[model samples]
Target: MIRLSRCAWPGERGAAAGVRRPKAAYNRGMSRNGRIIVAMSGGVDSSVAACLLKEQGYECIGVFLRVGAAPAAATDESGTQSCEVPAAADAGAAPRPRLRHGCCSATDAIDARAVAGRLGIRFYALNFEADFERIIDYFVDEYAAARTPNPCVMCNVHLKFGKLLRYADAMDAEFIATGHYARIRRDAAGNATLARARNLAKDQSYVLFGVQRSALPRCVFPLGEFEDKRHVRALAAGLGLRVHDKPDSQEICFVPDNDYKELLRRRRPEALRAGDIRDTSGRVVGRHEGVANFTIGQRRSLGIALGRPVYVTSLNVVSNTVTIGERDDLLAGGLVAQRVNWLTDPPARGCDVATDIKIRHMHTPAAGRIRRRDDEAVEVRFDEPQSAVTPGQAAVFYQGEDCLGGGWIQEAR
Candidate 1:
């Protein structure tokens, strides 16, 4: 198949918003040309994805991923309507509570169910607590080792695309769609590859780089072509979706209230022991509660008045030392990335391929040379010295709108 429309072409990946009316092919309710499972989050985007697919003549099944839970108080004392869904079945336990935040609570499932009812489709909730635990562990372990972690990347790799696709197979569904603002397109050789969304502000391709290339064929992005999020909401409202105005979940599901420190203290106290904050010269200037409280390029909360402004340049967990220096010290000429996964055929080792390496979800992709180090590693040498290249963050490689693949940032020097 070429493409549904030339408007869905690649060159305008970051183009401006456009008015959209659902094509007539989707507005008919009698056709079921293909079967799909939309990963509904109870948010407007996923809700609209299901609605659009249903309207577009696809038989859609709505699935809500129970990725995390809310507070105990957010539910009831009897465990009935509890915020957290237990890992296994409990006859005496109370059902999940209706959560207000819509991360993984009963509230999200309820919203999805309502949409499924309106669209006349089947709805199901699947448990993945064990998989979610590994993601939490990875987050804590990365901070314990003085590195930043991207939990979303791990979740996409192991849960959404990996496990969810397996569930789709059990239901005999051909595809598992998501509300992610990214696209999947094929190359001249008919290989499936990832691409940035038309809505540049909401592009989620960065966190999704870890998704397996083999699983690309089974994935669908219903919201990828919409440069304007408001258009999706408009479509939802026209379809009578109640969540058309629902607020997007802005905080991490596990670390709600944005307090990673408290979560770390409860789960990994060893990383929070008292430590020394040292100047670049190796002289101790002040003492801090723990290394977990600091991150690369942090310029405040050191509790020391060093006369001149200083930034955190590095953290050595083994030595329990925090190195502070001038702003220039935070810049890195390059970094080495490990555990690389290629969505396309990877260039040979020692072959320096031109790319734009995006270090963070929000950072601009920097022009760089990705020298294939080995089968599982690549060295990224930036055209200019990049700042605060923290370990544990994803280094997503891209060429124009096409996502080459990505890996974890293991070393910055």
Candidate 2:
């Protein structure tokens, strides 16, 4: 059974504190449109999303996913400050509270509850800690295998859209909405197509490539039509929402201290064994700590100096070695992706589908041609060689602003 914790407002003390309410309490006094569950993260973007949906006559139920452990103290109204220490911090110095900039913390949950109360909406904090741990395990496993993983993309695929959709169904809700800066446009035949938001700079279509195609019609993105974050904040401020100036979540929620290496050290120390750092010609230039400490295209803290700069070109888990080479070695003309997911119809095997490919979240979509290798795999040939085609990162495909599909990078060829 799915675990959940209901957040009650001040006026709902009686029912929320222990008084039982009827199951149909949520359905009574509904708005003109159907109910929509907003994934409120206690930020300006999600706050405005809830406000807009309410104004559009939809019964908005605000929900927050409690992903992390509760902090020692609650956060301020802005949800920007937190008291926490890094796992690798110096023990001699007085423990100072570091600025917590990640989402789904205790402070974030409180902020989300406050927003829901302000809007007079039914609020629920679902305990997703158990589900989130799986993502953390996936991160450790990927790094242990010498590959970089995108946990946010996987979170969207598995939790936000995956588990949350199930919750929506249980609640008898019509749609699940979020603050993601991506759009879904339906054609004349009611076929939903995912596209980039009006704000290209904040477009999050890359991370959303794994959303199940069938769920597109039921998904809603309120911030998709806005020009930028400024407008969203303004809307929140106008609505009297206290989180108008809240800072955007920066680091991974699970890695509050921004020290993934320390986390790996604790969780998978055996994977970080000492290994040989080899040059392109298989010559051991120096010794290193572990392959997990490095990623493709990284140049700093290499622990060896050959009087010339070198980048991590590849990692071998079987041999426990890190390969370094010139900058040119990081560029790749093609990549093979596994577990491919297509929002549109699957391209025929051996037929090249010309499209733009994004190797990483921040990467510019480069011109490329993707050909289906099998039912679950595809090969992408870049029009021009791209840099740092790291394995385990997503390779999202797009045609213009419409996101066609994507898959996890298996290897850069």
Candidate 3:
């Protein structure tokens, strides 16, 4: 039922900017005859997303995104172990080439098809290989180069929330929906703001911090209000989606088998060269396989012996050095962030707006104040020094559950 060739579509996959929005038909709290396109990932969350939209009376279509640049032939054999879903049964099952993990492989597409069949909706698989290379491949490269890269944030900005929104426009759909555990609500001013999901443990608003301000109104996250995974699984099982019991994918989507270093070696071997592990005094305490293999505050992989435990303080990609220091040295009073996107208008200069700042996805939000700097970056001064303020990671801002927007951390002061 699918083409065997690599190239299919002649044009780019994402939606073109400046396209006019289609007329929306739904009234508040009522079903709309408007069409909705839900991104189905062959998992319970998204599978239930499609079902919920249809239940709400929206004309629904299910889409599976095909990503990664490796030839489908190569991935056919190798992809099953890492794929979140089972491989689609095709004639060439024996030659199942291992595909790099975390993308739409043969299995995810097939599982998505089954869900669509159950829902009685139109299903289509669109290839987004080139975009994935640009967004995810470069992400891994940066990390291997000793810089922390947030691929999920990049995917949300460029692929899922960005490109998918565009595709919905081309299909004349009123809105694009996903299974992410984040909520979108319009405030009293009619401003679309991202909010933490009801399920705090599974809240994914941090990764979605980079969603463009203009695209906020056209997006929907059905799983945001469902606080528990058990309820979602129960709903899925009740709805008869085969992915009801499928384990949630916890690895980076483009990474093969969740091995970041292995993916780096396959793509860019030069990045894996050994580098010096230095201390605060610049003394070479030891040698490391690569600076990229370490991250800020990482203590497990130093392979160096200090009288007391030491932590990774910094990774200087230019010098190819990993700096280790005492854990106390990792604390910082502030950080400088680039590519800042504010959901509301930019705050005034020197404005001490009290907010919560999250340096990484799992880190608890810290009280902080954001001040605009001239170089298109924001200076975030934490009320208390936070640990492991890693560069190249995102520092997302929030006002309670509302997403105020965020920026990429360039440095932690």
Candidate 4:
């Protein structure tokens, strides 16, 4: 289980800042829409979510997760926050790098607190550094194993939904909400289903596939109905919230500079040893600094003089070799995924179901057939051959906009 620590801001009298021990008499029945815990990242989307939930008569509590990123103070006058990029170390001093991001910074925590204050809601900053470090380790390990890792998906699965839900239960909140662009639809029978947001461009349903089926009913996504980010920003601006125009966080929060290789070098230098790069004919075409530096579909930076383009077709960590081949060599008719989490009822072994498969977050959903291999695995065969069926990435199964389930890709065939 993930453990958390709470930090109290100065001048807050009792408990952690904005946190109050629930009274024995206090109950969910006291609130109009019960109590909700909002994961506020000091971003405009989450700010708007808190505002909307408050407007809907729900008692809201805003939470900022501090995952070891350096916090910069929010500007006093404008109440705006920006990530503090660490300066290079002075001569003879050991360089200490800080995680830089507009989100997950101290400035972001203050911005969230300011919004919560404006909305007349309680706010708390939770320390998730330990849990986040595990994520960083996962990011590094996957690369070391010669596979691409989707840390965002892992974060959503384990931290945002998993640990945050555990916190909500402790707080006696009825729901846990986030600014993710996804929807939870309830049928007449009150069964919840996850779906893509109306704004397909901003849809985050793929990463959210790991949410436990039983927990779907209590998961709330307030920004799902917004047609676009502009509408959400406009709402925040109209409400006088300061983060209305804050740029969306694009890079992975921990790797703020987007230099994963640099992180790997610091965390696991052994993974960066020079290796041989070979082609399909088993001939050494070139040499590479590391197998971790290449992914299955990468075409650039090969440092080879091949007259035609060649893509990374495979990586053998044991042999310490990267295999490059023509684009057609990357195509695969099917893939096997393990650790499947089915949002709906698990399909019986040997049953085949038609669905759309998404291999990556930005990849378009493709027509496919999924067959249950066991309770925890499935074989997905695409109607048409797909390129770059990368292992260690998610293969989310969908039926239209509804997210049925997903799993981690194990291999391609």
TM-score against truth, every candidate:
0.84, 0.85, 0.84, 0.84
Candidate 2 accuracy as TM-score: 0.85
Clashing residue pairs in candidate 2, if any? none
Candidate 2 lDDT tens digits, 20-64? 211111221332258888998877788767766775667788888
* Model 4 global lDDT (CA atoms, 0 to 1): 0.78
Q: In candidate 3, what are the lDDT values of residues 99-152, reduced to their tens digit? A: 444536566677777777667777666667777889866776778767788888
> What is the TM-score of candidate 1?
0.84
Clashes of 1: 8
Q: Give the poorly placed runs of model 3, Cα more than 4 Å off.
A: 1-33, 69-103
- C-alpha RMSD of each candidate structure in angstroms: 8.1, 10.4, 9.9, 10.6
Residues 210-317 of candidate 1: C-alpha lDDT, one tens digit per residue: 999998867778788888888877665555456767778776788867789898999999899888999888999999888888888889888899799999999989
After TM-score superposition, what is the CA distance of residue 194 in candidate 4 from its true location, in Å?
0.9
Q: Write the per-residue lDDT of candidate 4 for residues 82-148, one digit (tens) a residue.
A: 2333331221122223235747776666677666766767777776777899999999999999989
User: In model 2, which range of ten residues has the least summed lDDT?
Assistant: 19-28
Pairs with backbone N, CA or C atoms under 3 Å apart (clashes), candidate 4 = 71-106
Better of 2 and 3 by TM-score: 2
Shift of residue 13 alpha carbon in model 1, Å: 30
User: Considering TM-score, where higher is better, how would the candidates rank from best to worst?
Assistant: 2, 1, 4, 3
Superposed on all Cα atoms, model 4 deviates from the true structure by an RMSD in Å of: 10.6
Supply every candidate's count of residue pairs whose N, Cα or C atoms clash at under 3 angstroms: 8, 0, 14, 1
CA lDDT of each prediction against the hidden true structure? 0.77, 0.79, 0.75, 0.78
- Give the Cα error of residue 227 in candidate 3, in Å: 1.8
